[model samples]
Target: MSFPKYPEYKDSGVEWLGEVPAHWGVKQLKYLVTCLDGQRIPLNGVERYSKQGSVPYWGANKIMDYVDEAIFDEELVLLGEDGAPFFDVGKPVAFHSSGPVWPNNHIHVLRPGDSAWVKSIVYGLNATNYIDFVEGSTRDKLTQSRMMSIPLAWPPHDERNHIDSFLDHETARIDALVEEQQRLIELLKEKRQAVISHAVTKGLDPDVPMKDSGVEWLGEVPAHWNVVKFKYLIAEFEQGWSPQCDGDQAETLDEWGVLKVGCVNYGVFDPTENKRLPDNLEPRPELSIRKDDLLISRANTRDLVGSAAHVPMDYPKLMASDKIFVVRLHQRICRSRYAVVYLFGKGVRHQIELQATGASSSMLNIGQGAIRELWIPLPPDSEQDRIVHELEKREADFAALEQETVRHMRILNERRSALISAAVTGKIDVRGWQADQQSRQSEILMAAETRATYG
Candidate 1:
């Protein structure tokens, strides 16, 4: 294909592309693309999966189901039309493929003159923060007018094809690496859970005989340990203050209050996201969290409801949310960390789930009455300390590995986006590329063969 030659310019905010050939046109997103609102297929109709026949139906979240027909089979650029997912510089959006390719109003499907050209634009959009302008509560909605007004950089057909092919290969490679790292992270998390579950329930020395702790949840513990109720060990189990009162009660120190259900501690004790209570509001002494105090979520998603965190003394004074159950242990009876870990452990979580109310929405309200009655297997003080020490050391090592993996994942993501940004913006030219094309074709063929044989 013949291409046009042009002059270069300065201070264009196109640093990633260095200098764009002047002949290449710059147009508003509206000029280069049209937002073809996706046809909405009923969720029920799409629920049935047809293996041999049917078009793939897409939903805002992903592929909701498969239908027998596709509305637009030709490839297109799909943007999530709805939801509150954080889609910025490195967060890749998953688009749906198949029959009508229906995207919720929460999603917008872009039809381009050339599919290859649009892929380049999509990559650019993904790499740069593309939709920072669209704002709303719940899911951010995109207005067609506003979307068209966004800026777009376009290159000639040949140059666009070259950039698309290069990015198609490089970004996939980076994504594969990121996926591998994510899998490793999942494995580490599983191992962490296993280690915690084993240590707390069985103790370090497995040679000890196992005996039932009477409490069904405490199925088995060290033969020498005593099964005691939680109430017998803690000074008090206080519920959170009701903020619905006075409307002002819900008001935080700042505009929003601290101690909302969302602010409750999960894996870590985070006080930053708390709502601010009114300045003149009297602080509830009962809600005050002390160092090593185990705060457990009393109500939330089922899996996360029983999650707990050990409050560090250095943390500023913050009250527990209504959805959280703050465990003020009698330091004289049990070491706080041990209790925190025990309550947060999978074993205890299962018990909490069994006793918790609310089927559609799981609620973990182990009031002082119920919490006091809940049974715990208590090993001798020395044994508890020993187990805690060994577990803490292993946990620390696991946490360090997790942090390292996360850091590397971040670097890989940054590299992947940079690679796409570079390829799309003409920072690194990939024009008339032959060898890479052959290599990529070979790789795709090999992948197809592998999938056919194994998957």
Candidate 2:
């Protein structure tokens, strides 16, 4: 395919050059964009409007979806004005004022001003990474002042359009590749989880005699296994400490006294993402997590409500969330590792659902009372340990695979961002670019192969 060509450069009065076209101008964002025109509604007024008006309301959470109504009906970009994933900008963020709700205080609406070209303005804002300007020690928040103060590199109107169209096409291609990688990661995760769940719940020997374990989700276990409730093997189950308005947490610790949610997986107490609390702190008697304890999440989104993790010998003193259940196993009754794997398996999770009750607003919980009554299948100690050890090895392999996938994902993300930044800054010339023209095709192919094989 033939590519478009631009006129030769004649030192068109610009300073930054290597690949920048000579005619482009460097300008401030304030000159090109204007805040949406309207009387900013009060917070309570906006809420009432959402209830009573006929417009679509736009907020940070609603960026990916459309609402019933908006305050206005123009093509505009909405930016986050507050907490949680704070100061993020929504790109391709056009919203037609065709619904019942309007933009809220948590969103700042921006429109291209007379001096600005809309497409270029959006791309410029995007290339500038204005979202990073939102400031806060916590997640980060954006103020209107910060929103209007970002810098922009400007080109002549016609040049701006050319740059915008070029960027739109190129960036879309990169985004498509990134999206493909994300989908692959998801599939890998599902497959990995399936492998782990199967090996842990059922022994490696497919020839073992099977029988119904009484629980429907559990399907069948070895004929010699006994079906019993998890509560029967535990000494006790209960909540940890209650942090009132004042709790003695002044600094974060690593060597560990208490295990926060980050340390232990709330439901199954998987220590994969564990963080340590300072050893100087006093350990709460009830909350102290011991080796072989099964921790379950009491509260979370409905799907993750009963997700669990097994605490291993290496890390024992972890305390989980008030939302987690810690099951202490009786040595003579069941093997802790096997019990942990069993509780985290599909069947036990299905059983926990029966005990869970609550409104649509939030899922109610199942605590020690409900946990103690849960029936589980008990296998002989030797068989159980053997099954657990095999499952552990498989789990380790899965974890390693997951980590490698994440590393590739991070690298791809960085490269994708860098590609956009470089191209937009005019660090490389692509004026005669063709879809088949690739400067680093070999490196990209190598990365793709590695990702496909090990990712």
Top of the candidates by TM-score: 2
lDDT of 2 at 250: 23
Q: How far is candidate 1 from the true structure (C-alpha RMSD, Å)?
A: 8.3
Shift of residue 357 alpha carbon in model 2, Å: 5.1
lDDT (Cα, tens digit) per residue for candidate 1, span 1-455: 11112335333344323444454555566666666774544444324432224455555546554555555766677666556243654566534232255444556777766565667667655644445546666557656676666555567877777767766775677678778889999998778877877877788887999998777655788898888888878876666664532233333233434455555444667666565565577767657667777776777766776667777783334677677777778775677677867766777767777766653332334444546666777877777788778988988999899899998778777666655655454444456544344454234323222111211
Q: After superposition, which runs of candidate 1 have C-alpha atoms over 4 Å from their true positions?
A: 1-18, 36-88, 93-118, 129-145, 214-219, 229-234, 242-257, 261-266, 280-283, 314-317, 353-375, 434-455
Q: Across residues 38-107, which tens digit of lDDT does each residue of candidate 2 receive?
A: 5345344334433543355555535322334446666565556665343222232222232234676666
Model-by-model lDDT, in order?
0.62, 0.56
Give me the displacement of residue 402 in model 2, in angstroms: 2.2
TM-score of candidate 1 on Cα atoms, chains taken together: 0.71
How many Å off is the CA of 435 in candidate 1?
7.5
TM-scores of all predicted structures: 0.71, 0.72
